[model samples]
Target: MTQQVPDKLVIAISSRALFDLDESHHIYETDGLAAYCAHQRAHESVPLAPGVAFPLVQKLLALNTPDPQRPRVEVILVSRNSADTGLRIFNSIRHSGLDIVRAAFTGGASSQRYLAAFGAHLFLSADAGDVRAAIDAGYAAATILPSSGQGEGAGGQLRIAFDGDAVLFSDVSERIYKQRGLAAFAANELAEAGTPLPGGPFKEFLAALHRIQADFPQDAAPLRTALITARSAPSHERAIRTLRAWNINIDEALFLGGMPKGPFLKAFGADIFFDDQQGHCDSARVHVATGHVPYGVANEAPASLPFSVVSQ
Candidate 1:
């Protein structure tokens, strides 16, 4: 009989997101792939430093310690490097003691194509193109942003923060807001408060997480989730009612209205934060490990909109 893939929360991540490869990446960009391959080979024995998503991966792996035989989470490394060039990354993984045995080294080919093959619930990568392709392919994916500070969840709790519209829920409401402005959006939300919003890209991923959380005691659960959005008051009611209808429990909900999300996300000690808007992601990445979910109205090409520095 063949061994079965465990029914768990599967996450597919890139080598750059797992470890700090900025120096090596710079070599690849400036000198070319040949120099990059040679550099990696030369530094093969050196352990790579942790990147923005390191803490999140560490805490996620810790969830399995409760039941080694039956782990709740699985992380797969997906990279564009060839198997020969990937030995350094593998060695670093060993040095860091990360239990990431599975990998797909595409040898410069597109690695996002293998995400479904690994049963990945989420894909995180520093490569924006790969992330965009994965999202377009209907997988829950995000472009990992560079972070100045490390994540704050040092207690082993996996704290995940998500933007409400275009992330947890569908972009329908967001499209309305973008087309008709705030007042009309609020009115629409008010009228549809009782109706549940359509599920977005991350909906299935959140449901999977909820299932895992249900398996553990409330106090013992290793994960916590939050809905961090700009929606507030009247508009917020619809989001709340929508989650209730779905029977999903959000550990925390922060409706910041139009305020910047960076400060709030920092206070929350989030291991990772996801948002559809680049502006929100720009702010959040400074304080927490942030991922850009390039979807919905805001991300659409702005043909009629006037050019502005902020918009750029």
Candidate 2:
């Protein structure tokens, strides 16, 4: 009989997202693949410092301790480096004691293609192109951003934050806001307040986390979730009602009403924050670990604004 893959919350992450590989990445971009390969080989014995997602991965792996046979989470390393060049990443993984045994080394090929093969619920990478491709392919993916400080893993709690429209729920409301402005958007939401919003990219991922959270006592569960959005009072009702209809419980919800999300996320001590808008992601990355979910109306090249500015 063959061994079965455990029913776990599967996450596929890039080497850069798992560890700080900016220096190595710079070499590859500037000096080409040969130099990057050589550099990795030369530094093969050196342990890597943790990147933004390190603490999140650490806490996620900790969920496995209660039951070795049926771990709650599974993390897979998916990278563009060839197997030879990947030895350093594996070495660092060993040094850091991360239980990431499964991996796919695509050489210089895009690693996003293998996400579904790994049965990943979420994929995080430093490469924006790969993240965009993954999202286009219908996978829950985000491009990891730089962090202002090290992640908070000392608390032993996994705190995940999500954006509302275009993230947790479909971009329908967002399309109205983008096309007709706030007042019309508000009116639309008000009229549809009772209707449940359709699920978006991160919906399945959140459901998986909820399942893991259910395994532990609510008062003492190691996982905590928050809905941090730009939506305010009148519009917020729809989001709340939608979550209620879906039977999902978010530990916290912040309707900032266009206020910057960075400060709030920092105060929440979020291990990881995901947002569809690059503006929010940029701001939050400076305070906490952030991921850019390039999706919906916000990510589209605006007719009035330049592409770069809209994305920034």
The regions of model 1 sitting more than 4 angstroms off are 1-3, 304-312
Q: Distance from true position, residue 101, model 2, in Å?
A: 0.5
Candidate 2 per-residue lDDT over residues 71-182, each given as its tens digit: 7888999998899999999999999999999999998799999987788999999999999999999999999988885446337888999999999999998887776778
Candidate 2 residue runs with Cα over 4 Å from true position = 1-6, 151-154, 303-312
Candidate 1: tens digits of C-alpha lDDT, residues 40-125: 99999999999888888999898889888888888999999999999999999999999998999999988999988888999999
Q: Name the Cα RMSD for model 2.
A: 2.6
As a whole number from 0 to 100, the lDDT of residue 196 in candidate 1 is 96
Worst 10 residues of 1 by lDDT: 303-312
Candidate 2 local lDDT, residue 81:
88
Task: Give the deviation of candidate 1 from the true structure as CA RMSD.
Answer: 2.3
